[model samples]
Target: MGRNTRKRRTPLAAKVVAGAAALAVGGGGLVWANFHASAHEEGPAHHRTRSAAAQVATIDCPDVGQQLSGVPDRARGEVDGELATMDSQITEAYQRLATTRRAQAGDPRFVQNTILGPLKDRRKAIIDRIQLEIDRAGGRADDNLDQLAGCQGRPAEQPQNGDGQDGGGQDGDQNQDDNGNGAAGPVADDFIDINDVQPNSRASENGLAANGDGGSTGTFTTDCGVNENNLFNSDNLIAAPGVDNGAHHVHDYVGNQDNDAFSSDEDLANADTSCRNQGDRSTYYWPVLRLQDGTEEFDANELGGGAEGNVGRILKPAQAELKFVGNQQGDVVAMPKFLRIITGDAKSFTNGDANANSSWSCTGFEDRQVTDKYPLCPEGSQVVRTSNFQSCWDGQNIDSANHRDHMAFVQEDGGCPNGFQAIPQLQVRLVYDIPTPTVENGQVRNPYAVDSFPEQLHKPITDHNDFINVMDEDLMNEVVDCINSGEDCQ
Candidate 1:
């Protein structure tokens, strides 16, 4: 006499975040793939909590009595302004892409960050960085954008209340005495959109393009005269080799997948799976920043003294776990805060994996609710788990069944209680700013713009067919000379 009950699984990005402790054990970037452990493996809720790791890395949360830097109003203004500018830049890039082949809509020459990373990551980073700078200058002592723009030495604001309180202005009686001056924390070198672009990242040099500006990592083409149905008619597989041999896919998007019948047939099936994985499912995770003196106050800031040392909570590690979801080795699963399930470095550019930094897709087996109360989270930015289903634990039994509670969030909790959903473009820019690891190297890379790219396009921009793979300088020069001499060409 047993009842038939079925509970859905959670995604890997939704899994508990792995802290520095786990990282110390030589664990790669967090993922619930076969490469990583599952929630049920054997650890307790607090097993791999990140607080200790954050502390060890000198990335501590702001405690009481600590002063925040930068002026809130100024920081907001700067971030908003930068976003507006980036929005325009992103648009311009898209327009350029449009002029290319229809298949080029997804071209890296046009954009990757805009398409790959979520829009919010870019937007938030810009504003946050600006605010960080404003805070560093004692909240109102900033010199210029140059000093402000650099992502280094940013602290929260320190207010001197009258009667010699903090933020009590220059040379105040009691205010000057309590202020413990320390150099601002170091800022990330640049902004990067993890989605479509990799930016200023070591990953980019390995073959990933920081953005469309750098170059294409790969390319996909759309054959003319093909609707969703006739996609594989050789004529339909855009620049396909030899008639596409009657190849096609369910969803037009076949990442750098090969053009073959099985690939085509399996594509639709996989696409169906990808979309199925997201049905009525949304992720919840908070992007917390250390509030400090002079730091900009927003949603979390209103709570009072939440800013950090000119540094706001920048890296939001919360994302879904890929294992619980149906994502597979090659497919991608999107998680809130720009977290996605990706394979390890095994798939490098050298191996034809463009974003050699980290393979972009997560393993498909371990999808479970990262938190029991994920169902209670509202749909919007700053989505945090609603329960105590904490971080990863090794050698423990993670009951994936607990995730059933998350479905309730889809019905309740509410969507963006702020009811604020930026147009696709703005959403992309805002998220990349700060408290979100927006900087890749030392530049800005937006992801929202990709929505503007026609869905017809596939793949990235880079072309490596017969590319010279020589390591020696003189040998490379000789090879280039031979090619230039036209022996091969002739």
Candidate 2:
């Protein structure tokens, strides 16, 4: 890995303690910095100059795939392929957006006329194709699909000067600013000190009285090694089946070895397992974390890597804990084989946070988590990322047209809603031993970020996890029995 030869500042611990009071924690334990009140007052003059002149940061487009539903089974493959094409179109438009900053500066409507217009046209064509696939397969296409073709250019969010370390709070170099290093995102404002975040309770942990007696209190743990095999790919079988580079960013895969874009249920069932238990062949995967210290990974020039703005040294997790917890109301039923569940929204950056479920924190500051901002852990503390999957199943469908209508999270009162059945919740907790990022001269060096879609700019809010329940019926029953008996088992 290559790092810039810059003088380091005082230890991060001291700065964290200094700025502990000014920051406030938000949902899922990630802290959201109050830009005006928290941005350090003594940042360089360039920070203020850059904030005053905002530029187009990224392209924001409505997720067309999320809008369509009830596609026939026969058309799913074609519809998914078209949706993947739409993603590639967005990525291409974003790359142009990043490189055409000069052209944008010269013409006020350059983005609208040259970039967004063509992108919208391409997207409209893809959407039309998707509609044809659905209608041709004897399914009614949604009438509003054409409305989702348009996209808007979003100005870079300004980072306010704040009261902490050099990197803690400053101008948002979220655009093509020199400080941003052309990465399009993960500016100084994207991170906050873990010490500054206040401890917040998770919604799942509160108000369980409606569910009665914490049913199925036992847990089933699986010992799956932390992807030592280095199984990495950009394929998302659940979302864009049969489409290569569907994810746009690489994912760290564990469990089923045969999992990929072209993987069929039969292929997955016959795949080798990474779990200690032979019966559990489920596939579990999430985006790989990377340190942006100018290191050239093997995929540096690949579609899901540097070409898509996911440049960095991929960091293997020190610990990857996968556990199945019980529901609050009652014993969980066995999840059907080949059941696919996507926990968080991968395009939450442009799509909005309605379906965001990512959580980031530090080892010592576990109580204080942040949903949107990455945590800057103090010295000796490690970084942590967690995804709590949906625990309620529809009891009929193993998958759905939109991939989310088949499962859901528990309600505020801790019970499954309506007809949804309680199912074992898959909880993934990943910990990393990363070097603390240092800020010098108002630029963040060696910043760590999760791989994301090119247009997302590596926002932590877009972090997500994928799961496929390939466990045999016997193993699933054992898991349910273990939970119902209130005994933890591996």
Candidate 3:
């Protein structure tokens, strides 16, 4: 009696016709009064009818790998072929607005007057012609496109009444519910139609191989770049004002002065780095895997609204690994500079928890399947995700109480427990080239999505990560003398 406490049935004419199209779409008059005040109330089912204009708007652009390293070289092939057609129209507008249906997901002003205001005015005229071809090849135009074509407009609900709760309370057949609680009604789609699920054929048993027993003793790399910073805005700084303050969704930071959250510890040991070792200012972060394209352009501050917090756009990760797995008798140490760790489970997309350890694979596919359901990657190969952390810690908490009780998860031939201590086992790896979700007859249609929070839809295994060791005590003793001299430094 828990999966949100069963009991279903209620579409109330798709929530009174999506609350009368959000009061005929005029700033959704408080989503037509919270959809008739939760339309007859009920409990649990992870309750959520909160509306502040139904909360959506999220924009974060400008990190197409740091704008292709400031493009120069005579406009690097027309700014990499116009950022490959703007990442294929931002992954086909988030797969047509997350499969829109629920009685036309109540007007967020008709998805901002027809799809993200014309893809944010055609991505601000293609970042103003790639910032005039990177300022005529002199570079440094820093094309942020006015903070990635700022956006705003929410108000879209009514589609979650299969006892999964969320459909203006209950009342009879849009599907079923005679009270036995079998639940199965409002199907006019609300989201999560990653092509009716099933693709993860199961294969990757943690591929990335190379633990090679012998109790590993080397590896301490750190490239941490491209994911500049935009911790879902909430006033930029880390988890502002405390207790995971503003991170409603959207992440993509990287090391040290992680672009604010009051960075300290001497401001991340005097920050400044994209790490090829400028003394490894360790910070690292996650989230932000858009391509859902229903116009929330990877949202940031629409429902939470501004204060300079919800900045978006920041992709780049065709390849990124920041290894650190030591101790074969090496006794690695020195990671306390403001340490704060977290890994996987970002609400596992509303606690459905499909075996969440945060992973999704596809490179030439062999079927990986670990949950957040993913597949469709054939042509050339793409779509990857991996978030592995927890290197033992607990020599006096840097964070715990469910931020993962002081960390621990190493032994499976990887070692490091028995009163936890060995740090340096963080892995991130994300790559998404895009395109490959078109099957049709047997149903596949993907359009890559994963920048959640439209009532938490785009799952992709809720991949999560967040570290902050800001190395440098002689570069953390040169990563503990290159992992106790076993030597495999990158």
- For each candidate in the order shown, give its overall lDDT on alpha carbons: 0.20, 0.73, 0.46
Output the TM-score of candidate 1. Answer: 0.18
- Candidate 3: minimum summed lDDT over ten consecutive residues — where? 178-187
**Pairwise lDDT winner, candidates 2 and 3:** 2
How high is the lDDT of residue 88 in model 2? Answer: 77
Per-residue accuracy of model 3 over 309-341 as CA lDDT, tens digit each? 112233456666778756443355666766677
What is the C-alpha lDDT profile of model 1 across 1-490, one tens digit per residue?
Answer: 0111122222111121112112211111111010111112123433333221111111111111012223343242233233333332222222222122122222322122332233234334554565465666446523333322211111112111331112211111111211211101121211112332322223222222111221111111111111122221111121111121111111122112232222332232233211122221111111222212222323122111111111222222233221111111111111221111111111111123322221121112111112101111112333221111111111111111111111111111211113221000000000211222223432212111100011101111111110001112342233233322322210
TM-scores across all candidates?
Answer: 0.18, 0.84, 0.35
Which residues of candidate 3, in runs, are more than 4 Å off?
Answer: 1-113, 120-126, 136-210, 214-266, 270-281, 284-323, 326-357, 360-386, 389-425, 428-456, 462-469, 473-475, 478-490
Q: Judging by lDDT against the true structure, name the best candidate.
A: 2
- Candidate 3 has what TM-score? 0.35
Stretches of candidate 2 off by over 4 Å are 1-54, 159-182, 201-213, 440-442
